[model samples]
Target chain A: MPETETFVSKIFIAGSIDAVWREITKTDEPQGAMFNNRMHTDGLALGGQIRMRTPDGKYTGVIGEILEFDPPHRFAHTFRFTHLEDAECVVSYDLKEVDGGVEFTLTSKGVAVGSKTAKQMKSGGGFICKTLKAIVEKGRLPLHVWTIYHVLKALSFMAPAATKSENWPLKGNGDAQPA
Target chain B: MKTDSFDSIFQALAHPARRRMLDIVKDTPGCNVNDVAAAFEMTRIGVMKHLAKLEEAGLIHSEKSGRDRRLYFNIVPIQLIYDRWTMEYSGWWAGRMVDIKYAIEAGTNPQEPDA
Candidate 1:
């Protein structure tokens, strides 16, 4: 196989596995841990399409296809950023019940070496893990994150109309369709 | 999150050797113990000890990939520390730093020399 990089981030969340799983897989509201992006999906099924959009629904940041969707344990997807021009990468989440709480691990594979996606993935993984821990343990986002959420929501109107969820429907093939 | 306070992270980062070890692991993702040990003149056991401390602080995560354990530097702890200290003001500071850089590149010298 060609050279590719993998990043793994693990966090011990002081909460139940179900809670952690719910936070990661929530599709109804914006996920504060994930930059306040509300996940839009047909359902949690293998090969199903997925999209992460701004809370205000002005833009979609990421699109993916579900690879694995075992409840409360494993969830894997092929992630592709709508704005980035890189090949799709696989992201997986694993949750295990530990003594005090659940151990959550986020893994990304097939990342092109030294690509912009790699840089974003590296920085984003840590932020996601840290925010997820805080949200799960404290039941709220950090003050800074809360401020960012509001700022992002307020500025979402400036996002390109091509990124609207209506333009990128979840009925396409596994490949990301251009709007 | 594992009952570890910021003190643990600070202590892990206190030693220069440990900091260098972290850099090695970060530069070479999916590296193994031997790969890291080869970079330092210290004994393998000494390197392992430092790695242990880094792992204890959640700075490094190891996964068993075949017979060799793959080591990856985790940045969450450092990010958490950074987020704790800097808030919205940090963005303004960062913007100013970028502006200073551009001005310096253009020979504008926005800030006056220190007295």
Candidate 2:
């Protein structure tokens, strides 16, 4: 049976439209972190293709031509995750000026109903929105950054095992019996 | 291990309904299933499913009292996850910046001219 799901997320970023655009459309740099790849496209205009590349030169998605484009206001496009059949979806971004920033809404439609990808799209969408907000407001990576920090802290405490030498003295060496 | 934990947290948070539920609970304490369901266009069962996911993710907790199952926010785990993920990336960026600074001081372009 065919299933369908939709996810929407909104965030208020305290920055100008140009700044947001640069971050949103960046092909390289930290802004690419949210997409997990560099967006390789000429522009984000109507009928303009939005493509992204993996570090290994693999094509992740062949984003359809932009359906809508309004600078600092809105952008919409169709996305096809190349490796997954029936993984076609529409992504739209609506931006509005708020008291201290811009309120942006990201909507994804046509996700397969009850599929793992849909479930993930729902939650991951929100995280990405929040992460973008944090980035715009604080100029930082936010949640992913925090996750990495804690993991390193935990690993730092366990690095002793890797530094251990095979010839290291055993405890109570003087009293140790011959093997 | 950390990446797995991070992935789980992200997976749990991927849902829009679940995130909205978290915000509701965070703003108001002791909200029941019905109250949460009322906030959305989805059916009670739909909301309950979202709640179940939230509960499983440790983002929220629930208890029953007098035929009412009250859900409360548990934001600590989210904060912990955020701290873990954000810090790692930031550290990497910091190291790169340091390298860039050293390169500039040596009268060379810090970044590779072209990839």
Candidate 3:
């Protein structure tokens, strides 16, 4: 069996801690920083369930339970992507107030080395942090991200009905919906 | 990202040994100082110094795991630098491309009345 590893990514966003936290925990709309994944959660509390779904509610990408929910500071969850066949990993977001802005950090553990999920997380971590920082600080996304978001929006109609939000409830059979 | 942070990041990455140390830590997460030092012919203190520089640049962070300190690379500072360049230049080029595409279409069509 491959050994597990921990990955950490951090960013300095020129914004208040509250702004950074809001972007991370935003549930009402799609977060462009998260590749247009709209967070759907039962509530913002410990032990509640959360999932990242498409903007049109047509597909679900990630599903996990909240492990920590400290407001404006720390939020941790067991992240398991629906598309990858890997063990659930712990992902935590830590926001600290700095001199002129917030220092946002993302840490993940229990990722098997060289796994597909690990590869994705390694690359995804940087882009996510960068996009989140840009969104919180500049109020916009990079041009490539903007173009990808629109393309995903345009392709939403091709999503399968089985993957729609209505099919995946907050309390499901303790298994991820296959992508 | 601040100017000094870039200075530190680039400086830390300037040395071939430091960059190799970074790659080791990045490729092997949770690796310790000794694990990184073993790969080098330099003295342990020398490796420590390079690790310190990398840590100072926010390129790697360490946590005490029992008796050993585990090191993991942090990609945020580099990502910030990347976004800084791409966002400014890419946005400009994308806008220009759109304008040029429209110009080409308009010039070739000659069908629609001029606004």
Candidate 4:
């Protein structure tokens, strides 16, 4: 019967295994307001606490810990959002060398297939995987770049007719490219 | 774009107040310092500092029209940054990874894209 566990999501990260491994294991910081500015981790070693603070400054933090820690290959932890619900799952990051580069797969299970808990877990799981991909690949915050993009887009809307006609700062001919 | 220019663009965009000023400059092309400063709660000098940053970052085009300096929003740097980060990565994460693989095989390759 399709294995009794629930796996959330996965993605491929194109980078060296050493580089990818260093990024995932080196440091831990709060991923902005999503995690209530708190992703406290005692360490990445097996049995270390991996506290993920959910939204709300007053709500009690979820208490999860490192369950598996195999450096340069696998790192799994208790993915729980106790503050939101009794949501409990196992989030695993597996890095394997493939044809081009390393493929990082994030899997989370222990929640129902189509349940709200599953969705939340998937979102979080996807976020972690994407964050790793962005860091190892782009080497910057994707959201920050995305934010600048929207700001530029908003600014472009107010451009006068001449601004489009002139294309003053652009490199090539004045085709009036869209931002 | 050059990496230094890219860094300046991001550094200039790192402020919310500067972002708001950029919006004002966009809505009012050829707007003078005073015209842009009126929207912000800070002193005119403070506002000018932010405007100067945007100008330096190539995010705004400034013109000396008669007695006043008018500013217009420039989006080229932003577009290039978008292309570099999003367009380059949105697709071919692995296909581009293939390029990295070849780069690896080709030798230490001074342009190993971060190695």
Model 2 bad stretches (over 4 Å): A28-30, A59-62, A146-179, B1-115
- For model 2, the TM-score of its B chain against the native B chain is 0.67
Checking candidate 4 for backbone clashes, the offending pairs are A6-A109
Docking class of 4: incorrect
lDDT of each residue in A13-61, candidate 1, tens digit only: 8888888999989876778888988887777799788889876665889
Q: Per-residue lDDT tens digits of candidate 2, residues A28-92?
A: 54243354444545555677665544332223433455789887678788876543455678888
* Ranking of all candidate structures by their lDDT, best first: 1, 3, 2, 4
Error of 1 at B95 (Å): 10
For model 4, the superposed segments whose C-alpha errors exceed 4 Å read A1-5, A28-38, A53-62, A144-179, B1-115
> What TM-score does structure 4 among the candidates reach?
0.42
Candidate 1 docking classification = acceptable
Candidate 2 chain A, poorest ten consecutive residues by summed lDDT:
A170-179
Best model number under TM-score? 1
lDDT of 4 by residue, A87-143 (tens): 566777778776566766556656655566666764555455555667777776577
Highest-DockQ candidate: 1
* Per-residue accuracy of model 3 over A89-175 as CA lDDT, tens digit each: 999998888778887778888987778888888888888988887788789887778988899789877766655666667764322
* Global Cα RMSD, each model: 5.3, 22.0, 9.8, 26.7
Model 2 residue A125 distance off true place after TM-score fit, in angstroms: 0.9
lDDT of 1 by residue, B89-112 (tens): 886898799889988887777686
Instruction: Give candidate 1 misplaced runs (Cα > 4 Å).
Output: A1-3, A56-58, A172-179, B90-115
Q: Considering DockQ, which of the candidate structures 1 and 4 is the better prediction for this target?
A: 1
